[model samples]
Target: MEQAVPSSSLEQSPLQQVQARIAQAARIAGRKAEDVTLVAVSKTKPAEAILALIAQGQRVFGENRVQEAQAKWPDIRTAHPEVALHLVGQLQSNKAEDAIALFDCIHSVDRPSLVTALGKAQDRLGRKVPCFVQVNIGAEDQKGGCAVADLPALLEQARSAGIEVIGLMCVPPADIESAPFFALLDKLADDSGLPCLSMGMSGDFEVAVQLGATHIRVGSALFGER
Candidate 1:
């Protein structure tokens, strides 16, 4: 993994390089770079790495587990007080409250049970997290997204439960052309009236930007090998 380097500005660091790529992609797609939010996937990276990026003005970060973020982020947030943490992994229904307590946004609300759990947690804690309903865009059996057909029902359930679903998220089948999957997600978001899309990663993010991805989760590209 690339060691986090302090004082790395937008001109030469890996983070800056990724940001530049996103901007170039957006420009090529006729969209403004500022509209595409780059969520640095900081899962498993140490606090030093996170703090280094923070010093570089990276306020948005993503984590795979609530427990991990809880352990490392409280002190960091207490110090910076402006960081936005997002949960970008499969979240168990039982962990809804914990997820809500730490993450400002959640990108894995895929089932009715999870929606119900999150709803109760929100009501009890008075904390509302902007959510993204992950879509099994490739129909992969092993993936964690909601099947394409079930999205509408699940979204309705979230609406009834007062969960704020902000967008659609997906992990396309690996080792294949991701554009089709990204394009499909864009269409699904349009049909569902969602304004944002959290698609793309280290490999296919530029394609995702061209296809209307509002948020891209880039991990290895920014932090190096996991």
Candidate 2:
């Protein structure tokens, strides 16, 4: 059995602040606060930061790298059985099996090969992990998401491969107004009949929530600058 972290209000403040913001944003959107799930992005941060948030009662967290998450999370999850892990970074088809065994949700299913790999891994593991198709909403050449025009076909492939796609994900180009991009993702998700929208980060989560984000990947706001 794993021991829980010792509690402290000071240590819990960051999580509280982010949660409050989520609630506020949800209200502004005329949506229930409970409808939004906050995935505290924990990539590149130390285990202590995660432990602190765990102590603060945060159970869902996001990681960017499979290897880094593999290095830290097993021990942490051993201590906290209820925790849910999400993969919020680009995924390679070769890493499908490892990722299927580790993450509860995969937020970067962008291409057909990766989709097929994840499908095979899920069948082998006997555990179907929910996925979110990442859309290149801004059409940035450097991003990992699929082109907006390619989403429908990619989604069809994921479904054909027996992958359960629950939502859509995106990382808008940095240092720009993200509201329009967020709105675009929401529309795309709606058009695709996806029930969840995994948008927003530490900086613009509130705007994202206002624009209908179902899952907000917040890092610095909850764990403080890594």
Best by TM-score: 1
For every model shown, what is its TM-score relative to the native structure?
Answer: 0.95, 0.93
Backbone steric clashes in candidate 2, count? 0
Residue 80 lDDT (model 1): 86
lDDT of 1: 0.94
Model 1 agreement with the true structure over 135-157: per-residue lDDT tens digits = 99999899999999999999999
Q: Tens digits of per-residue lDDT for model 2 on 91-168?
A: 999999999999999999999899989999999999999999999988999999999999999999999999999999
Candidate 1 runs further than 4 Å off: 1-11
| Decoy 2 TM-score against native | 0.93
lDDT of 1 at 114: 95
Candidate 1 lDDT score at position 109: 95
Model 1 worst lDDT run, 10 consecutive residues: 3-12
Q: How high a TM-score does candidate 1 get? A: 0.95
lDDT of 2: 0.92
